[model samples]
Target: MTEETHLNPTQPVNQQIYRILRRDIVHCLIPPGTPLSEKEVSLRFDVSRQPVREAFIKLAENGLIQIRPQRGSYVNKISLNQVRSGGFVREAIERAVVRRAAILVTDAQLYQLEQNLNQQRTAIDRHQLNDFFQLDDDFHQILCDIAQCRLAWETIENIKAAMDRVRFMSLDHVTPHEMLLEQHWAIFRALEKHDEQLADETMHQHLAEISASVLLIRQENRDWFTEEQ
Candidate 1:
């Protein structure tokens, strides 16, 4: 809830609003438990309340916010159960994705993965957390593409919101970027050699980091998480 930001005139207003708001939520820009006013968000984006309402509905569906009819809407606190469950599903899906990628990946696709790793390293060195986060996602997305299963990435995206918040927090606190980078390298090497088992195992270890780091993250940012665990 700050000054108005420009929006793409070509894109659907509601989707633009949703993506921006989603990114803000995931990055903790609008920290958990913060009240969200439809009018304020509309003013911030220089849009009508209808689109903002639509975005809010989508956010609610994603469990990033709670909209109470008689009361008001607020960003939902991270649910530990949701994060752990999401991580579990993500690991199961991505382990399979990496294994398939190992069998199907081409030299060109492997080079793309290598480039992403390079960008990740540069982002870390420059302390560009946002850039590194995007690179990290792109690395996984590329794997799904190589596996010829775009729907797999789509499925992960839907369930990964809560997990993403903790991931952002972990990156800022306990988790080291270098550690994640090494894991990516391990996965990439397995894919390069077409080793399905190694690819699956490395991907499991990589995705499991979120679960492993969540307890420490919740301890550090206690207010950001729900007590309902």
Candidate 2:
């Protein structure tokens, strides 16, 4: 709602609603445990409740919300176990993906990646946290593209919801944007040299950063996380 004033009529209404709600949830703009209502959301988006209901189903599937019959729906608190588990899986998949990219990446692909890095730097300079967040994901996605593993990135997107919440928080509190940009550069350099091992290692280290920051972030914002695990 805060990010986009209006949903594009050209896109599927349900998809746009799902993405906007997901972005709001991940950014903690709506915060954890906040109640959600189909009627309210439909009113907010000025669309029919059917698309809002469809969007809620997708959010629940991603573990971003809980829908209770009669009880109503609410955003789910961040799960430490889910976040760590998701990170482990993502790191394994991405490590392999980056290694493969190093071997297969062409000069043109490297140039494209360089342009992405430049855009990342610009985002950082402009203090555009959201833009930088998207660009960071784009950099990793580009590597997956170079490796010819679109499925790998798709799988990551499905599993990374909890990880994404922490990632957004860490950008402000734990990991500095400059440090992240440097890590991106390191991974880019390894790909440029076709150093598969270095690429694998850098990707591992880069992804491992979130694991190190999650605890501190939880401490700073205790209510955002669940205590069960």
Candidate 3:
């Protein structure tokens, strides 16, 4: 594993604040149903209420948080319906992408994939969970690109914004990091051999893990979830 690194030189102050708060919400730092106030964020970040409001708007737009006017904002709660819907959509798109990648992946793309896998492996070995998580995202992006399915990936990204809350929770319980690594390797092997079935299966299995993880998170953190309301 490699040492953890951070994303710096990001967007301007408001966007950067939005990104930070959004991630914290998704990662459960804010927790579901916890009230968030414009005045609180403004005080904490030593900024005016306007940037905090802007950040809240971005989060609300992405379904990560809710702003109920005078009632203030809170982290968005989980919905089982959303998870099931996301799983179905994500699984179908990724299966097709993996199959296409098996046929159309170029040597250069394969090389890049190998590099990404190596980065992930290093992150895992070093126990750099944050870097590992980010690389996991990169690994999937590269596969989707190799398959010429950027549009599908863009769609997934929007769904994933909501799904990430459960994903981060499941990340806490998962001991199968090696299984994830192996799945990526399996996809690479299929691409090398131009084996469509194998590639499709590999991606299918890889993507399916998210569903299982979400269930585990909901079970383990039941308090964070409402009664499907």
Could you say which candidate leads in TM-score? 2
Query: TM-scores across all candidates?
Result: 0.96, 0.96, 0.84
**Clash count in backbone of candidate 3:** 4
lDDT of residue 150 for candidate 1: 98
**lDDT value, residue 14 of candidate 2:** 98
lDDT of 3 by residue, 140-221 (tens): 8887898787888778877776677777676645636677888889888989999999888878878788877876677777
Highest-lDDT candidate: 2
lDDT of 1 by residue, 80-155 (tens): 9889888888898999999999999999999999999999999999999999999999999999999999999999
The TM-score-based order of candidates, best leading, equals 2, 1, 3
What is candidate 2's lDDT per residue for 94-128, written digit by digit as tens? 99999999999999999999999999999999999
Q: Is candidate 1 or candidate 2 better by lDDT?
A: 2
Clashes of each: 0, 0, 4
- Rank the models by lDDT, top first: 2, 1, 3
Name the runs in model 2 displaced over 4 angstroms. 1-5
CA lDDT, every prediction?
A: 0.90, 0.92, 0.77
| Model 1 lDDT, residue 77, Cα | 95
